[model samples]
Target: MKHTLYKHIQEGKTTGKKSFAVLVDPDKVNEATTEQLVSLALDAKVDYFFVGGSLVISHNLDECIRQIKVSCSVPVVIFPGSHSQISRYADAILYLSLISGRNPELLIGQHVISAPTIKKSGLEVMPTGYMVIDGGAPTTVSYISNTAPLPADKADIAMCTAMAGEMLGMKLIFMDAGSGAKNPVSIAMIEKVSSHIEVPLIVGGGITNPEKAYLNCRSGADIVVVGNAIEKDASLIRELSDAIHSVPVRV
Candidate 1:
């Protein structure tokens, strides 16, 4: 693992720079669609491309990754919904743990099954702690992981969970509202969790507009992830880039 992507994230932390990542689920985006997104990402200065989904039914993950790598300069990080989502074509993998839930599979069982393969794939494994917050609806991630999200207003629960993840040595912390959520993670939750953790904070799901994306960054998120929003409106990429990068990332 060269860690180019991880290093880029670290540099952002050091310089107080915020980043934007566009999620391209292979189940959702094809090769042609991926090329188009990558082209737009290059122009928008999207810092990373997150490639994966909760239920990856498509067999074209590798092909999509290959096309994006050929078309873009941004790092492609594997946002795996499961161990089966692995691909060496990516620059890195967010090795996630569903710490907000007690599901043994997401926490370590799946990792146990996939670790050997992931080790062999050579993708930069970023140990990420994944927390799902109530997004005002039932999300695919919540359903798939068999875990309930933390209450939207329970900042204390979210913060303590993130603190536990950091103490356990996670490299990154992700606060997700689940894809196609009715709302993004609340600004209060982002502030509470990020203030306590030293790791880079990533917030995603249902951030449909630049305003929400911008607010996430301003609230202390180091990275703002937009997927369904981009899939709905590719033009939002540039605006979201401006929104997130507008505020300096502060830990």
Candidate 2:
């Protein structure tokens, strides 16, 4: 079945709830560990699974996605870092444009390279406006993408960047703090962006606890993505899911 992420978000809104997603970076975990993680995530009642990495130095991207798709019942989406990460096995891809960075490579260069392959794969393409916020530390994404992050204190700049993306016809806005961040994207920043953008807002990175996830949702984030946190303690998944779901839906 073809999965529509936008439809899922609308359904959540209609049902008056928020959703939880878990990110699985294949490059970071071994096969045995990945299998266990998939099982744990499935058991946790996570709404979706996102698979990808900033640097997939491993040539096993396709194999890793295949395994996860076969092992888990939840929808598996590709949160790709580069064009090379595309595969037919996944349900969809977050076709991201790094709007926050001045680097033209991430903004349009990579998309041009990946477009043909993506069209051929017949995967659902979710046009996402990606904005990286300062995480209080240097992160893999910031280093590899060669783009400086927007200062965490600068909510106004972030707002304008996101609005520009929406005007450019992007479907969703993802505000990320980069994995293993010293601090997650602030609630103030999330609130500012969420209030401005008409598209669904997805907040991620450094969200290590249920409280943090809950706070993001309460601040108006339409979806919350958790990665490194669950990798360390798989058992926290259920708690985080419940916490995000506990927030009152925005009217």
Top-TM-score structure, candidate number: 1
| TM-score of each candidate structure, all chains considered together | 0.97, 0.94
Clashes (backbone N, CA, C under 3 Å), per candidate, total 0, 0
User: Over the stretch 1-251, how does candidate 1's per-residue lDDT look in tens digits?
Assistant: 56777877878866779999999888888767777888888998989989999998979889999898887667889999998999999899999999999999999999999999999999999999999999999988998999999999999999999999999989899999988999899999999998888889999988999999988988888999999988989989999999888895456
Candidate 1's C-alpha lDDT? Answer: 0.90
For residues 1-251, could you state the per-residue lDDT of candidate 2 as single tens digits? 24476688767755557888898888777889888877777777788888898988887778888888888778878999988999899888999999999899999999999999999998988899999999899999999899999999999999999999999999889999999988999999998988887788889999999999999998878789999888888788889999998887657
The 10-residue segment with the lowest total lDDT in model 1:
242-251
What stretches of model 1 exceed 4 Å from their correct place? 249-251
